[model samples]
Target: MRLSRAFQPTLKEVPSEAQIASHRLMLRAGLIRQTAAGIYAWLPAGLRVLRNIARIVREEQDAIGAQEVLMPTIQSADLWRRSGRYDAYGPEMLRLKDRHERELLYGPTNEEMITDLFGGAVKSYRELPQVLYQIQWKFRDEVRPRFGVMRGREFFMKDAYTFDADYEGAVKSYRRMMLAYLRTFQRLGVRAVPMVADTGPIGGNLSHEFLILAPTGESGVFYDAALEEQDWLSEPVDIDDSASLAAFFDKVTHFYAATDEKHDEAAWAEVPEGRRREGRGIEVGHIFYFGTKYSESMGISVSGPDGAPLYPEMGSYGIGVSRLVGAIIEASHDEAGLIWPDAVAPYKAAILNLKPGDSATDAVCERLYAAGAEIFLYDDRAERAGVKFNDADLMGHPWQMIVGPRGAKDGTVELKRRATGERFELSVEDALAKVLGA
Candidate 1:
């Protein structure tokens, strides 16, 4: 998008309301705007980033055999009541009454609703193992919502539900999702350590929270360094095999990782001194194997092999699609501005026209823009070179294709990699080849 004609409104001064790096930078860089306390209107660039993150999430979910489905944001309170959680869920759930005088609530999570839907559709054991997912907005009435999207009251999330016929099958589904989450984080260019966490209102003995290390995080983290060493994307675990999944699960969970709330100093000491890593962490995802919590409460069941009633074991997995935007910025920004990773950047590269009116610079930039206009953010604004440079850095595109009159005159462009601050002056052809991977 050309900055001159774009709706990207950048700020020179940080808003006082933004207390965190991601919050401040997001507003300053024109990624989002606060419409209400803890509620934001994602601007163009921000929406692009949000969609990119969601797309990655959807892809990863699909790879794990999860079928995509769209569930409602507003759930019937009756569903919660059926699950015996309407009163127990507390005020974070926005309970309300419709104009028809029927009770309803904005769903903070979808355990009860999904159980209702799945129960209504599948009655036989033929559909015993199924993973259904959705990328949708969720609401929680946080009394004090803060941290921008990181703790927003209404945010986009990817929640997947898994149903299995037996405890053993549920365990396999749970492990498969764990593997999927790790791979998803790796693809998003972040290392989110899976730590055993409390189930809370979700109500499951088995639960894990994926935390990204950041000083501004809400929880203190303790883990073995080896947990971060493995490349989950390359792991050879067969999702179809229970033994393989179990081995993978053991390989990961045995490494000793936990938040301060669950930290055991004895287990901490058992980790080799060299492998001990303690730091603050921001939660970006969570998974729970609640077994019969929802199915039993909602009276959801399918036929067993012998034709008796069976409550399908249930599990839910979630990745904070919107909060990840903030958590990623919290984990990866520098003094200049945000430093977006390649996979999740709104734009792969930015074309900065240092001399917008100058024919040579315009020619070079226009040529670069033509090469991949959709994938490039062309900063053709009539601004000073320094202004363009600063804005390019602030916007955090992975590559900056600097088009100055001097280089433009020789048909060369200065390409700078934003993450590493590495610059290379090359001919237009070479620059295009490098940035666009020609």
Candidate 2:
């Protein structure tokens, strides 16, 4: 995409209200704009990143046998009432009434709706093990929504629900989700540790919160240092093999990890001092096994093998999709701006025409752009070399191709790595090969 044609409203200076680095950078980069307190309108650039993250979430969910199905943002309040959470969910629930005077709500979560859907169609154990997910906007009226998208009242989330006929089947499904979450975060170039967490409003006996450590994070966490080095991608994960899933669970649980809500001082003391890590963390994902909490309450039952009526065991998994964009910045950014992971970066590389008006430089850039490279070409009408370079760096594309009259005269262009700040002069073909190969 050409910068001149793109709708990026980048600012020359940081906004005064943005206190944190991520918030400030997001505003200056024209990624998002606050429409109201705790709510935002994602601009073109921000929406690209959001879509990339959503793609990764979808890929990982599909890998674990979870099918995608979008649910409504507005759901009938009667469903929540059946789950006995209409009164219990508190003020965060955005309750309202339609023109017909029927109760409605913007769903904070979809347990009730999912249960109601499952109960209506599923009637036997043959459809026992089913997992469905959706990526959609969710709203919770936070009393104090701050820190940009990190704690926004209206945000995007990928929520998945699983229904199984037995306790053993439910546990296996939960482990598959845990592995999926690890793979999802890893692909996004972030190391998110799975820590035991409180069930909170989800109401479950088994739950885990995937946290990414950042100094400016909201929650305090205690975990083993070894978890930092573990490579989830290298681990053998077989979603259909229950034994493999159990082994993966055991490996992860061997370490001591817990959020403040579930922190055990005795367990922390047991770890060697060198292995103990206490720090702030941001919750990027959460999973829960709630047994028959929603199913039983909503009359979601199926026939067992013995011909007895059985309420399916259930679980829910969630990833804070919009919040992760801010969390990724918090976990990995320098003084300049965002250091986007290549997998989630809007553009793989940025082609900066340092001498935009120069005939030779334009020729080289034109050839490079024609070679099917995913890049943001800086070909603006009124930007200086320094301005173009700074904008490219601030946007954090993985690679930067700088073409100038000097380099064009020499039949070369400078290819720079955004993360390492290393530069090398190469022919147009060579540069294209290197950047696209990455």
Candidate 3:
């Protein structure tokens, strides 16, 4: 991907309307462009980042045995009506009549629709515990959509629904999702803490919101420092073992964690003064155990072992796939630009051709680009060294391979790590081995 040929329309000046660090940096980095009041067209760079994030999300969901499915963006209004929410959902839901005068809606959530689908297919206790998920665009007509993707009217989300025959099973499903969410954020290179939260319109007594800490966040959070040090990926929790899952759950919730709304002074006093940590955070994901909320409302049921109809206990888990892009930026960026974590970086490194026209420098860059073409974004444009440096830093690739005329003459190149601002002069092969990995 050569900068000269790429569709990266980076801006020189920040958009006046962008109110947050993520929004401003996203615009200047050419990641997204606003098309409507709360809608956006993800540019090439932005789309790449979104896709990378979604891929990681999908992988983590699959690891937890949740099968992926695609549900339509438009759902029948009657579905919500069946769940007793059509009229109560408020103006945030975009409702309209179709060509045939059939009431429909751009789905804000899929609880009712998924309940109907599940009931129509599975009719017995044997199919009791099932988890299905979809990664799709959702709309919520925010009255004042701002902060770029963070508060957009239209955004991508990963929503998963779970069905269990009994309350006990439903709790297990919820815990499994909790574990999965923790692992997912860890892999995405962000420390997201789970705090007990209100259910809002989703309607659940048991709910947890995952918040990513940032200086400019909407919610102030107080949590135990130990929550930030877990190696969740290495924890051997057998999803099938009830005792194992319960132990894992207890371990996670053992530490006192809360947002301002739910903070308790008595509980705070129990945490060691030194171990208590306070910060602001952005909500990234949420999990809910709303047993029978949708199933009972939609009249979805399956035959029990005793041949009696039983409404399945249910739960909803959601991760704001698109909003996470902005939330991550909010948590991870520096003054220069977005410091993309290696897992979600559009390109692992950018090859800066300091002297593109010079045969020596050009040769070195060309060789390096050829060695790892797929993961490299070649800055082949005839731009000044300072321009290349700034752009590379703005893009925030993990590594920047600088090919200078002098370094080229000596068969050496300077590799700079964006996050640490550390530079190393190594031979062509050595640089390749370091950046591209051995």
Where is model 2 poorest over a 10-residue stretch in terms of lDDT?
372-381
The best-first sequence of candidates by lDDT reads 3, 1, 2
- The per-prediction CA RMSD against the true structure, in angstroms, equals 1.4, 1.3, 1.6
Per-residue error for 179 in candidate 3, Å, reads 1.2
The model with the greater lDDT, 2 or 3, is 3
Per residue, candidate 3 scores C-alpha lDDT tens digits across 382-414 of 889899889988888999999989999999999
For model 2, state the Cα shift of residue 340 in Å.
Answer: 0.8
Q: Whole-model Cα lDDT per candidate?
A: 0.90, 0.89, 0.91
Error of 1 at 152 (Å): 0.9
Error of 3 at 251 (Å): 1.2
> What does the lDDT come to for candidate 3?
0.91
TM-score per candidate, in order?
0.97, 0.97, 0.96
List runs of model 3 lying over 4 Å from the truth: 200-205
lDDT string for model 1 (155-195, tens) is 99999999999888999999999999988998898999999
lDDT of 1 at 100: 98
